[model samples]
Target: MPRVTIKEIARRAGVSKGAVSYALNGQPGVSDATRARVLKVAEELEWVPNRAARMLSAARSETFGLVLARTAKTLSEEPFYMGFIGGVESVLSTKGYALTIQVVPDLETEMAAYRKWSAERRVDAVIVVDLRVDDPRVPLLQKLELPALVVGDKSLAGGLTCVWTDSTTAMTEAVEHIAELGHQRIARVAGPPEHGHVWMRGQAFAAAADRLGLTGTVVHTDFSGDEGASVTRQLMTSGPDRPTAVIYDNDLMAVAGLGVIHELGLAVPDDVTIIAWDDSTLCRITHPTLSAMSHDVVEYGGRVAHHLFELLDGAEPAAHLNSTPKLQIRGSSGPPPA
Candidate 1:
């Protein structure tokens, strides 16, 4: 049977369209008797809310939405994104769904996009990333009854199904590797503190350094190469207690730091060792071939998307632990200079 419209309900209920609307929406304009009559007619005609049409039709919108709160510059240069998106598409393509991405300036705009998509019925589900502690999107998305896959630990997911990596283990391993290589002092050029993963890594780094009897500090950055270079310059040129090893949050920043080291006539793994969190092709092709905590980012993304599909099928999937990034030693990391 076709979806019953308000006009049909009005005709069958012997009421005007406005009265039908008022009755269906529980507005006060309609009398009690009229409201009952309208509801009865709606039930008899099998009328349902517009939002339920897709469910009853057993047809998906065939679109999944991803709203990014990153700048265009970051999006353009970030190698991680290409691999992740490729993996998501690998899954979505087989399922006949298209991924729609929107880049927004901040969390506000990102949330607004979700609202617009929900109201317009532009997507059947959405993927959320960059979760912060006490994230506001959790409650709002739940209220909208939108299916969402959170791309971070459950600490920020507010009980939503999630796929997360063991960043704490990765960060700790990086520090332990450097420590084993005789790096006494260490620092991290970390992403914004508001992000849950960044905070987890920061905490893990400090804990690992403490356990190994090393000094560790973290400085926040916007995950840009320029910012990474500037931070590297400052840390390397600082006081006598300056770090002998530095960890970067991404490959781009690590590469930028390498350039800064070169300009300062410093040698990697001798003057100061470096480790990058993400091991991309860029990490492999760099001059010194940066040491990194390595994982298959594309496969990680694919796993996340897979969980989202489960959620769409009414499986309230539990939080998933993908895997910890293993430390891959390379030319850029070694013992501190004698």
Candidate 2:
């Protein structure tokens, strides 16, 4: 049988289509008995509201666009974007909105994708992530007057609203926690320096270490586990005074560093302690669970969506979020060995 319509429900319930609409929308004017009858009929027939028709009648696309800066091949190998996108999509689905996601290799290709989405009127708004210092997208978004939100703290205040985690605070707290563990020397496996968060967190790490009366060093990499393992090996193997505690920008590298520690015959929380940013299940599954600065990725995505809706409503306001990442102690961190 075909899907039931409101008209069929109204006919079966001996009511007008307008009465069915009123009852379905919970609007007044229909008698309680008639409303109940219409609703019962609709429920029995399994009728669903036509979201597409509703959006079209309102002259709105009810969709948003996301353009990725990496190639399709590279995207599959990365877990961060996948988890982040999943969170974003979950919120969009609940709001009866659609997400138009595209992948491009470079800035030029990303620009082309943006143009195509704009020319086709495919999205009501756009979300830009992985912001770098002096990103080209800043000027482009301003020129287009696009309703956009950036995921990092860039100098786009006059042009675009931004949503950022307090990477600086998180990094600072991680270093301080290690210092509290009596760790005097600290090292960080940091993301690329161009990215705004990476730079901010690196600077904050230094400041916090100084405040805590400790030494800090940061090794910049491409946010890859391979780079993390290599850097950890070099940092640990070739030093008269190697760091007793390490902080990582992401979980993948932290997991990789765990392997390096074991291979070098080092005991975690004994000879070395590790704390990672962006906690995930991989941390818990390791031999000794990794301690980390944790935040809710799902909630972060929902917040971005909430702000985008505000922007779409012609609200010319600036918004920034500094999510406080809390330290979750596990088997990976402890007081310095006596």
Candidate 3:
């Protein structure tokens, strides 16, 4: 459909273009009756303001950007981002703002997106995710002077505004939950070690395992279901002393791991128990519902968006700790097999 223009509105309302502009903009030049008439005509025509023109004139795009450096396949299968983005939109839509999401294959392309958005004044702010140690994006975002909110621990935020959950604490709790159930051998299927959260969780898992006198193993994956299944097979068959409990970084991988374990003719909890991060719907609906480090991920995303809006409102850059994910026990986790 063609865009409804001010001229078209003016023609229909029996007014000049200048009068239409004044009426639409709620300027002093337009009388109450004229404004009402112009609005009615615009409503009839389904007219909407040109965002680009509004941005140029007002110097505010009212748009937020998020760039994901991950494969489309992985992203489609992962439920965390879906819930997170929904949370972000829940806030953005209420405020009449927009979100621009770009999925790139690597960090370089993701960086390019930030630069382009900043250069073009395309977004009022950006949300940075999957932060790594000494993340290049942090410095680039700083150099570009782009307003950004980092979605990682403050240690990895490089003094930027951040909203994060305590992965270390949560990992400790998860490990303790499994340990209490008499599982001495535990394994974690984590995401890329480069991710700050994964690294933090890995360290915490190791420390907690050591503190509890348990054997701990960690394997890295791309947070894909295929890799999750493959790694589970390897872990289960690699030796006689296999881990009795396995933890996965996301719901997709954990679900995949469950299938692999079943394929190997092992029963959940009775043989190898499973725990997954992010208590998504998949976790709940599985044959044996997964145990998970449960947090309100949608609310977590909303909090991040809220903090970004605060920063845009001239609030100081600071770290806000969201809730730590609590271990939610379900059918998949129990005492190891006798």
Q: Is candidate 1 or candidate 2 better by lDDT?
A: 1
Candidate 2 residue lDDT tens string, 233-290: 9988967789889999888889999899899998997988999877767778998999
Q: Which sequence of candidate numbers ranks them by TM-score, best first?
A: 3, 1, 2
lDDT by residue for model 1 (1-338), tens: 58789888898888899999999988899899999999999988888787666556655778899998988787677777778888898998898889999999999999999999887778888989889988999999999888898889977788888889999889888988988888888999999999999999988988999999998889999988889999999999997888999999988899999999999898987889999977989999988889998989899888877888888889975789987889999999878878
**lDDT order of candidates, top first:** 3, 1, 2
| TM-score of each predicted structure versus truth | 0.82, 0.78, 0.91
What candidate 3 gets wrong by more than 4 Å, as runs, is: 1-50
Candidate 3 Cα deviation (angstroms), residue 24:
4.5
| Model 2: residue 321 alpha-carbon error in angstroms | 1.4
Q: For model 1, name the residue pairs that clash.
A: none
| lDDT per residue as tens, model 3, 153-246 | 9999999999999999999999999999999999999999999999999999999999999999999999999999999999999787999999
lDDT preference between candidates 1 and 3, better one: 3
How many residue-pair clashes does candidate 2 contain?
A: 0
Which 10-residue span in candidate 2 carries the lowest summed lDDT?
71-80
